[model samples]
Target: MPTLPHRLLHRLRLPALLLTAALSLPTAAAPATPAQRLADIATRAYDDQARFDPLSATGVGDHRFDDQLPLSHAPAERARRFAAWRGYLKELAGVPVAALSPADRLTRELLVRSLQDRLALAPFPEHLLPLEHMSAVPVQLAVWASGQGEQPLRTVAQHEAFLKRLAGLPAWCAQAQANLREGMRRGVVQSEPVVRALLPLLADLAQPDLARNPLAAAARALDTPPAGLPVADAARLAAAYRTEVAERSVPALQALHALLQGEYLAAAARRPGVGWGSLPQGAAWYRQLVRDQTTTALTPAQVHQLGLREVARIQAEITRVAPQLGFTGDPLRDGGLLAWTRTDPRFRPFKTEAEVLDAYRAIDARVTPQLPRLFGKRPTRPLDIRAEPEFTRATASDHYGLSEDDGRPAGVFWAVIPDPTAYSVVGMGALFLHEGQPGHHFHTALQLEMPLPEFRRRTWINAYGEGWALYAETLGHELGLYTDPVVYVGQLRAEISRAGRLVVDTGLHAQGWSRERAMAYWRDVTGAGAAQAANQIDRYLAWPGQALGYKVGALKIQELRRRAEQQLGAKFNLAAFHDQVLGEGSLPLAVLERRIDAWIATQRR
Candidate 1:
C-alpha cells in the first residue's frame, strides 16, 4: 500500500553482537531523576545508533555519516555495533519504571523492546542473507546516486563522501560473498526463486553503459561547479567520481553480478524453498520474524486462523457492496464484478495524467476538511501528487512514498497511471484514504513532528504502523469519502486484500502451501488476477510474516478503539482517542494496547 516497512527503516538492520559501551548520562553533580535518566539514556542511545548505522542515520536526518556506509556484515563491525546495542538496553534497565512518567516509560519500553528484539534475532545470521531483490545494495545505490534518497549529494564534501561510499561497495560485495559462502556451508542460502528474482536487477546495475547507469550519472553531474564553488574544486570532485565510481565501482558491480549468477544462485535452494521454514533453524526463525514483525506472541498457525476469520468478514462486506452497484455475480470469483469493475468503461474514467492527478487532489480536498474533526495534529505540507513518467507506470495502484526528511519533500501521493484509460476509478478514493491524507501521510508526518526521543519518534512497529494506516481506511465513512457505494466497496476490497495476506502469508510459510496454491487462495479472497496474485505471493515469499502485520495491526487498533468507546461512553472524544494512538509515534501493538488501557483508566479516574 504505502511502500513496505521502510518507514521502520527495514534496510537499517541492527546486528546483535556481544560487547559493551558506556551509556552517556547527565554530567550534573546531582543524581538524575528517573525521567531525566530515561531522557539522557534514550538521547545518547539514539545518537550512538545513528553513528552505528550511517545509512539509517542519513534516513533519520543525521548527516554526520552521510559519506560512509559501514561494512555491517564484516566480522569486526558487527561486534562493535552489538556492544552499543547492549548499552542501550543496559542503560534503560537502570531506569526505575515506577519513578518515571507514563510518557517517558513509553519511550523506555519502545527502546528496550526494540533492542531486545534485535538481541533475540542474534542467532539468525541475516547478514549472510543481505541481498534482497527489492531494496538490496544495488537498488539503494541507484536511488542514492539519483539524488532521490537519504544520502545528500548537494555539498562538495557530500559528493566526495558519496564517492567514498561507492568505493566501499565493492568491498561490501566481497564481504557479502564471503558471508553467502559461509551461509552455503551452513545450509543457509536464499531460496532459488529469490536468487533468480534478484539476478535481473543486479545484471541491470552491472551494465557497462554509463548513460544508463545512474551511479555514473551522479558522478558526471559533479563536473558542473555549484553556485559558490571554485572551478578547481569541481574538477577535483569530478575526477574523484571518475576514478572511484567509474573506473573502480563499475568493475566491482560486474564482479558481484558474476559471483551471484555463478555461485550464490547455484547454492540457493530449489522450488518451494520460499519460506524460512525451508532454511536451517527455519521454524524458529519464522517464529521470530512473526514476533519481531507483529510484536505479538501469536504463532503462524494462530495468525493464519485469525486471517481466515478476517478474510471472511471483509469478503462479506465487499459482497454486500456489490448489490448496491447493480452487480450480482460472485466477487469471490476471478471473473466477477471485482474484475469487471477494472475493465468496465464506466469505472475507467481518467484519460490523462492530469485527470488522474486531479482525481487524487479532489479526494484530498474532500477528506482534508473532515480530518480536523478527527485529530488535532497533521502534516504541515498538504499531500502532494506526482505522476511517474509514462513508461515508469508499471501498476495501476497508487502509493505514498515517505520523503527522506531533508526538507525537499514530505510524503508524496504517487499516482501510477499506466495508460490512464486502463486505470479504474473504483478504488481510487480508498487508495487515497490509505495512501494519502489521514493514512500514511498523516501518521508518518505526525510521527516526525513528535517531541519524543529520536528513536521513539522514528520507530515503525509494523503492526502499529501498517495497522494504523489500514484502520485509517475505515475513517472513510466518517470522513464522508465512502458514502458512495463504489468507494465503500473499494475500501472493503482494499482491506480484504490485506486480510487475504494474513491467510496466504501464513499459509505459504507455515502450512506448506505451494506458490500455485498460495496464489489461488490470494486471488479467491482478494480477487487479484493471476499475475497480480503471483507477484504478491512472491513478495510474501520474500518477506514472511510481513503481510500479517497489516491485518493483525489493523484489527488490534480497531479493537482498542472499540474498547475505548465502550468504556468512555459519551466521554469518549474521537480526537482524544486519536491523539492517544498517534501521540507517541508508532508503538508495538501490545504496548499500544497498554497505553490505551492506561488512558481509559485515567479518564475513568
Candidate 2:
C-alpha cells in the first residue's frame, strides 16, 4: 500500500476553500444567469463537505472547522448527508458548463462526480468495516490530536480543542461498535487478520498507563498537563479512557475479534485479491473505484492485462541487468537478485533511528544539486527525515509531510522503521528519489509555491499525485542517481511490487483469493517477508483499488513522456516537459494529457 503524503490531507480539505474563492471571483458584467446560479449552489455544496468533515478541512490548511469531528459511523446522519449531496448534484446538472469558465466547469464536474461516487459507495456498508490494517479511527484521531500531522497543537486554545476532541472518543467508539454490529448482521465484516491485529491495538490503548499511551502523549505535551488539572476534570477524562477501553473500545474489539475467529476467519476465502466483484454489486463498485482512482474509463480487465505486459517488460529489463550484478542464471527463478539485494551487508540495520534518518538526509544532500537540472522550480522549504512513531510504525508507510502556512515546519520525509535491518540500502536510494529530493517533496512543495487557484494548489487527483511520484522513480537514472546495479534493481523491485499489486489486489477481492495466497504471491515475487507481505495484503483489503493506482498511473505518465519525446524530436525540452506536468498542480490523468498535448502543440508551433 502507498503511504499518503501528509500534505494530501490539506489537499482533501481544499475544495471548501476553493468554493470560497469561486464565490469571490468577480461577477460577470451582466446579472448572473440560472446556469451561474446553479454553479454557485454546487460550489456551496462542495464547501459544505468541509463542514461535514472538519478534521479533513484542518489537514488541508483550513482552520475554519477545527473544533468539529465527523460522525462517520452514524447511518442516519450519513444518509441525510448523502441525500443532500445528491440533491446538490441534481441541481448542478441543470447548470450549463459552457456558461462557466474552464476551471469552474472542472470543479463542477469533479464535485458532481465525487458526489455520485459517494452515493454509490454508501450502500456497501463500508463504514461498518472502516478500521483496518491501513488505517483506524484511533490512529487518525491520535495523529489529529498530536498537532503533528497537519493539525495545529501549538497554542493553549488548540490544546484545549484537542482535549475537547478527545472527550468525544467514547461516543465515537460506541458508534464504531454500532457499525461493527451492523456489519456482522450484514455479513460484511473486515478480514480475520485485520480484526485480530486490531485487538492488540485496543489492548495497548486501553492499558492503565496513560504516560506511555500514544493517546495520552498529546495531552502530556499540552500547556496545561492533565495531571495538574482540577482533580475532577482529570479524573473524568482518565475515566473516559478507562471506560472507553474496558466497556466500548475493548469489548467491541473483542467481540469483533471473536466474530472473525469464530466465523469470518474460518469462512474467510483463500487468496488476497482486489475489487468487490465477489459480493453482489461488487463488480460495479470496483468499476467505480477504478474510475475514481484512475479517472479513466479503462476496465479492470484492461488494467490487469496492462499489468501483465508491464510485469513482463520490467522483468525482462531485470534479467538483462542480472548477469552484470554477478547472477549466473535465470535471475527470476534463482532469486539471486532478490536475495542479494535483501541480505546484502551494506543494508544492515541502524543501531538507532537517528542513523536511519541521517541516511535519508545524506541522499538529499547528494540529490539536491541535481534537482535544478531536472526541475526549473524547486521547493523553498527544507526537507527533513524522521522515524515513524513506534505505536503506528507497524502499519505506517514512508510518507512526506506538507508545510504549514507559516512555513515553520519544513516538509518531512518519514520512513517507517519497524526493524532497522528491514530498511534496505538498495531500496533506500530509489525510495529517497521517489519520496524526497525529486519525488513527493519536490512535487508537492512546488504545488504549494504555485499561484494556482487555492483548490488546485491544495487538492490532488490520485492519478496525478501518485503518478508523479512513480514518474520520479524512473527519473533517477536520468538524474544520475541509480549508479549501482543494486540500486537499479531496487527500482525494478519497486515497480514489480506495484505491478504485482494489480494482480494480487484483483485476485483477493474480485477473484476470491485468500490472505495466505496473496502473501505467498508477494513473497515469491518481491521477496518481501511474510510479515511485510501480510501488511501489504491487509492494506489492500482495507482500501480496494488504491494499490492499483501506482503502476496504472506510472504507465500513463511514461506513455505521455514517450509520446512527447517522439513528437518533439530534437526540440523536446525535458525540463520544460517536467515543468508543464508539475506547474499545473495535480489533475486527473485525462485533464493532464489534454494540458500536456496543448503544451506540446505550442512547442511545435
Deviation from native of the Cα of residue 543 in model 2, angstroms:
1.2
Question: Could you give candidate 1's per-residue lDDT for residues 96-170 as a string of tens digits?
Answer: 999988777777877788787777777777877877665576566666676645565766777777777787788
Alpha-carbon runs more than 4 Å astray in model 1:
1-9, 12-31, 219-243, 269-272, 351-354, 387-399, 404-409, 415-421
The alpha-carbon RMSD values of the candidates against the true structure, listed in the order shown, are 3.6, 5.0
lDDT of 2 by residue, 1-605 (tens): 01235423222211111121212222355236855575566545645666665555565566676655556557766666666677777777777778787767766665666667567666565566555544565666665544456666555455456556555556666666677666666656666666666656655665556566567655455435344346555445445444443454444445544554565544333313233565446777677777767778888877877777877787788888888688775677634476567876765766767788888788778888887788777779788777766777877777776535233756777788987756677788878877776778777778777774444555656777777887899988986667788778889988888888888877776677777888887887777867788778877766677777778777888888898999999999888888988877777788778878988888888
Q: Clash pairs of candidate 1?
A: none
Candidate 2 weakest ten by summed lDDT: 13-22
Residue 197, candidate 1: how far off, in angstroms?
A: 2.3
TM-score, predicted candidate 2 vs. hidden true structure? 0.86
Q: What's the CA RMSD of model 1 in angstroms?
A: 3.6
TM-score of each: 0.90, 0.86
